[model samples]
Target: MVVILGGSLAAACAAPGSGNAQPTAAASSAPALSSAPTCGTEPVTMKGYFETGFPIAKALTDEFTKQHPNVTFDIREDQFAVITQNAPRVLADDPPDLMRLPQVSELVKNNLLKNLDEYAKVFGWDKWPPSQLQQMRMAPGGAVRGEGSLYAMGLNFSMTGVFYNKKLAAQIGMTTPPATLADLDAAMAKAKEAGLAPIAQFNGGATGGLAFPLQDLMASYGPAAPINDWIFQKPGATIDTPTNLQATQHLEKWIKAGYFWKDVNAVDYATMMSRFMKGDGLFMFNGDWESGNLDKQMPGDVGFFLMPPVQAGGKQAAMSAPLTFGVGANAKNADCAATFLDWVATDTQARTIGVQIGGSHPMGPADAPMPPIAPGTVTESTLAAGAKIAEDNGSMDFIANATGAIYAKSWTPNLQKLVGGEQTPEGLLKSVQADYVSQVKGG
Candidate 1:
């Protein structure tokens, strides 16, 4: 049974049912093949619009083409903000077979995305762990999330945490993951004193990445239920609470202490990752989606840990949710598109690609076999961290996902101001809460 929080949603790994048995195969053994039907041998070209700076989708599509040579992909890429703004127009005017999704409530309310429940049954997706798809379900008209018809699916389930450079960590005499928030601060201070960037974060562009760490801090300071309530648009939900204020103040302190890059307001996501990989910073607040890339670029130089809780031995939390994707309401190749999505979780090769290249756990039945991950790589660490989150029941959806425009409009500018010393922690929460209210009321 899924553990409900805030009377609305479940933790990322918690879902609505039990008795779903796991596959008994070991990691090294070939996965049991699904009996589901494929998209057939018809010649088809799937149109796709994907988020930029992630190669996992492209890699998956390429492999799918290799297996089903008659089906090819015509894909386009854009930054997250661009995709968020363009999703409506593009989905209504010229729809793609599949597209990376952001804040899906508005789209569902607009009837711009296909209802995927039928596809779910066709592909046996209903048999998978329900929590894996819970976030994607919504009521008709998008008034509520976490319950209703399924509309989207994840390429993989991802979790966010602190990823550190092992060499830089050693320089700070940090050999193990920080045990608490204070310990993490001490380590960051040491890195700063050692002439290293403490936190290599991206707060620039319309999609401010600072929300990543801020939300993680919120979880570290308090329970994740309120945050999820706000994101899911539960009645009477608000982000400007005492606990969140404390979380925001903590982030503000980090900003004022020079832990973050001096020019963080000008650095975009790609630039942040590039800088972090170049060993310019001791740690980065990011998701497991980058695990494969970091393992490839840094080898064993990187390590991962959850956002340490405020007190020692306290439960840990992070923004853990699916890397969501959906079919357009008017998609020409809807059946094939869905077949591809189901293949992502059920096919052995596709699951391996998701783990090795996507750096995320494939979304499927509880018993699905995970591809082998080398013992010391960041990917392995992140996967282990995901399991820890499951045990602690401390997973959250990204706070920027609270509303369709919340990230680009409220969080980004407000955070940019916080970085520039123009916004107070109190004011930041107030401004964002106001924007969230306005958007939710369709003002």
Candidate 2:
């Protein structure tokens, strides 16, 4: 059973049932292969559009082409900011076999995406963690997520956490990672006094850098049900509360204490990450997806840890979302695309390559080997941290995923003001809540 929050909301629209029976490869009208085709000799080419996650996609397609010499792929990769708003416009004129979905509800409502439920059954994807599956299901009319028709699947999965600089941590008289939020606070203060930025973050364009940290911290303060409900757009859910207020105020306090980069407002994500890679800060609030870059640039210097609990050894949670992808309604080679999607979950090489090169967890067989980890490497620490989150079942959706407009309409702007000393934390929270009510709730 899926461990989704808001039982009523999940139950509002029923998911089509698939029992414990395996489905055949020729589950749809697609031609069945003779001699058990690992690849077919058909002359077909697939087009795709994506924002990030290209490494995993490229790896899969490259390997697949080796198996079938006639198959080819032409995928366009772009920065997420460029394609997010223009998804619909681009899809209308130039549809690909697969594309990254930025506005799921909008795309679903407009019939722009193909439902993956049939493919999900054919692939027996139900065998994966139901929680992961839940993230892809969307109710009719796109009013609810986590149930109904399947629309997307993640190429890779990631969880948000704190990335620390070992050299800087020790320079501040710290020998071990923080075991609690209090310890993290003290370590940041010490790092600041040591003339290094405590947290290298960017809130200038998208506030995810700060928002994720605040959400991770808030996870420790109360039951995750309420928070998850709000993120899932449960009708009565709200983020206006003591715990969230405290989380917001905590970020404001950090900004006031100069814990963030001095030019945080002016700095964008690329610049902030570059600064952190240069060891300009003690900790960077980010996701495990950055592990690949860190592994390449500062292999032995960086490490990862989820935000510790309010008290040591308490339950921990982190904002996690799949690096999701969807099929276009007008996809030319969807059958082959489905094969590629299923391969990620069934083929060991695809799964391993995704983890090793993409720096993310795999949804393959349960017994799949964890990627080899090197001592003092970001990959080692991040994989370990990701394991704990999975063990605890502490994954939650990104807060921005609550609605299509949440990030640009509220979060980035309000958070900019909060960090700029132009808006109070409470004011920022209120503004965000207003956006949720307006866009998600239609209030």
Q: Mind sharing the TM-score for model 1?
A: 0.86
Residue-wise lDDT of candidate 2 within 62-151, one digit each (tens)? 887876678888889887777787786666557688787785777776666777776776677767777776677778767777678787
- What TM-score goes with each of the models? 0.86, 0.87
> RMSD to native for every prediction?
12.3, 10.2
lDDT of 1 by residue, 1-443 (tens): 34456445533457733333321223112123445446788899899999998888999999999999999999999987789889977887788899999878987876778887767776788898676787898876689787788889999999899999999999889999999999999999999999999999999888688898899889988898778888888889999999999999999999999999999999998899999999999989999888888888999999999999989999988788998999887778877888899889888999998998788988898788889889988889899887788778777788887777788899999999999999999999999999999999982
- Number of the predicted model whose lDDT against the real structure is largest: 1
Segments in model 1 whose C-alpha atoms lie over 4 Å from true places = 1-38
Give Cα distance to truth, residue 335, candidate 2, Å.
Answer: 1.7
